[model samples]
Target: MPHLVILYTSQLDGETDMSALCRHLADTMLTLRDEAGKAVFPTGGVRVLAYPAAHGATTDGSGDHAFCYLNLRMARGRSADVHRRTGEALVAAARAHFAPLLAGRAIGLTLQVDEGAEVFDGKFGNLHPLFTPP
Candidate 1:
């Protein structure tokens, strides 16, 4: 399971479209594959969402800066290398997506990958079949 969440400051709202960025990120993740060429993340399990921060400040408490934080959460069991590669890919995607917004402003971009409990519970249905081959 992979869930991608993008958190950005409201300052960039008029400069960029967060919803479209989230879709681009999700599509990028879906294109990633393991060494064997198999999809690294399940197509049906990919989820991306964006949230605009109402109020935020920089390290010096300056409200003039903007920030974009990406959080990728997935089930545990993948190797460290896998995690690193995935993070790199996603961060690159984020950087490219926000390039225009970063041209003239001080924007802080960061990516975090969280490996959650492997024993978590969930129920998924028809979505799986859509991605499965006959």
Candidate 2:
């Protein structure tokens, strides 16, 4: 399972479409596949969400700056290379999404991939069946 959380300053709300950006991210992740060309991430397990920070300040408490932080949380089982590739793909997508805003102002963009605990408890629906063929 992979869950993406995007946190951006409210200042960029006018310039950036958070909802669209989230969708783009989700779509990008779905494209990732292993060496064999099999999908690495399940379609049903992909989740993208965005949050606008009402009050945030950059270094030196400068309100003029804007920031976007993307965090991808997933179960721990993939290799370092996989993680790196995923992060790169995500950052590239994000950069493209915010290219316009980047040209106009100082926007700090960062991506982080977090590996969850090895063992955890969870529940799910029959969504996986949709991805599986008979």
Candidate 3:
């Protein structure tokens, strides 16, 4: 199977709710199915992990590095387009929820795939990608 990681960074902290944000992203992931017409979650085919910015990770309006990170898992046969679409969906979600605070800041969203030895070795592991943009 292929694994996906989505990293989003924001500029505001006090106004954000990380738990709700995680739920929203999780729900969104559940709504996406593969070409085989299978539900991604609860079938062992999809998994999502969300992370909110750590307390004191940033300060001041200009120093805030508030972020939400999501990791997704899917079958290896999935295409990059599918991953891209998923990333776009996350961006849209962010825009709807945090546009005002993120506006004019260094907000970013990125999606990536992981196909490691374990992935091809018919075993699942606990590896996830990290936010890479500075």
Candidate 4:
């Protein structure tokens, strides 16, 4: 399972091409790795998802609003605060990276995180450390 998953969609326009979006996403992933390196999550482990706009969706009819979503998964043993922080980081990354492309356009971004039970030694199943004492 990936620690981070970033999903982004933008209006297909002259300014916002798929290649540019991909590059931006890649840069964001690098930034994420750098940030994670300073923290507990494994570095260079962030995974991003690419979701193209719905079929036949056009920038003219759709009003050129980009939708970005990010999802993160982490060990359940950690506190909810950690997950919250991760979500914030993901949001910040989107805002910082896509701000230029989203300029003068309606853009929406969301973040969701799932916390799973911690697996230790591969023999024991997920034991939510937050709920159960070690």
Candidate 5:
């Protein structure tokens, strides 16, 4: 499973479309593949979530300063190269998505990929079954 969480300043709610960005990121994630050309992330297990921070400060808290941080968490079975590719792809997609805003406002965009030991994982949902081959 690949989960992408996007946190951005609330002011952006009036400037751009967060829902569109989420779909863009999710679509980008679906394009990832391993070196052997196998799909990297299962379509059913991919999720993109975005939250607007009601309060935030960037740099000196001056001059239309805004920020967006994207965190991608995945299972710990992928190779280092795959992890690297995932991060790079997400960042590239985000930058492209925010181009219009970045040109008009001082926005900081950051993306990171995290893969840590899962002490306990419990998943309950019917979404996965919808993507299974008949």
Candidate 6:
């Protein structure tokens, strides 16, 4: 399971298009491949979500300093190289997406990929079927 979650400051909500960013990230994830050339992240299992933080504080609390934090949670098994490439790709995508806005405002972007041990895992959905080849 791979879920990319984006948490952004509300200050950037007016200039940021969360929907577009979500699509951009999901599309980027689809392009990642493992050592075997197979998709690193399954298309059907991909999930991207963005949330605007209404109340939060960033470093050097100044005037409307915006921040976007991206966290990708994926299953553990991939090689370190694969994870590095994936993280770099995702971060690059985010930077490109916010380039124009970055020029006009002060924004901080942080990204990290986590593969934590889960005691219990459960998934129920029909979306996976839609991505399967007929």
Best by lDDT: 6
Q: Runs in model 5 with CA error above 4 Å?
A: none
Cα lDDT tens digits for candidate 2, 44-127: 889999999978778787558888999999887787888899999999999999998888888899999999785755867987
TM-score winner, 4 or 5? 5
Model 3 lDDT per residue over 45-95, tens place: 344544444443434557545555555555455566666766677666656
Assess each prediction's global lDDT (C-alpha) against the native.
Answer: 0.85, 0.88, 0.52, 0.55, 0.90, 0.91
lDDT of 6 at 81: 96
Misplaced by over 4 Å in model 6 are none
Query: After superposition, which runs of candidate 1 have C-alpha atoms over 4 Å from their true positions?
Result: none
Clashing pairs in 4: none
Query: Tens-digit lDDT track for model 1 on 31-116?
Result: 88777787889998999988898877777865488888889998887778788889998888888888887788888998999998
* Superior by TM-score: candidate 3 or candidate 4: 4
TM-score of 4: 0.56
Span of ten consecutive residues with least summed lDDT in model 3: 125-134
Total residue pair clashes for candidate 1: 0
lDDT of 4 by residue, 1-134 (tens): 34455556535344455455445544554454323354445334434555655544434664655666666665555555655655666666666766776677676667787876665525333433443434
lDDT of 6 by residue, 84-110 (tens): 999999999999999999899889999
Residue 79 alpha-carbon offset, candidate 5, angstroms:
1.0
Off by over 4 Å in 2: none
Better of 3 and 5 by lDDT: 5
Cα-based lDDT at residue 34, candidate 3: 53
> lDDT, candidate 4, residue 42?
36
Ranking 2 against 4 by TM-score, winner: 2
What's model 6's TM-score? 0.95
The TM-score-based order of candidates, best leading, equals: 5, 6, 2, 1, 4, 3
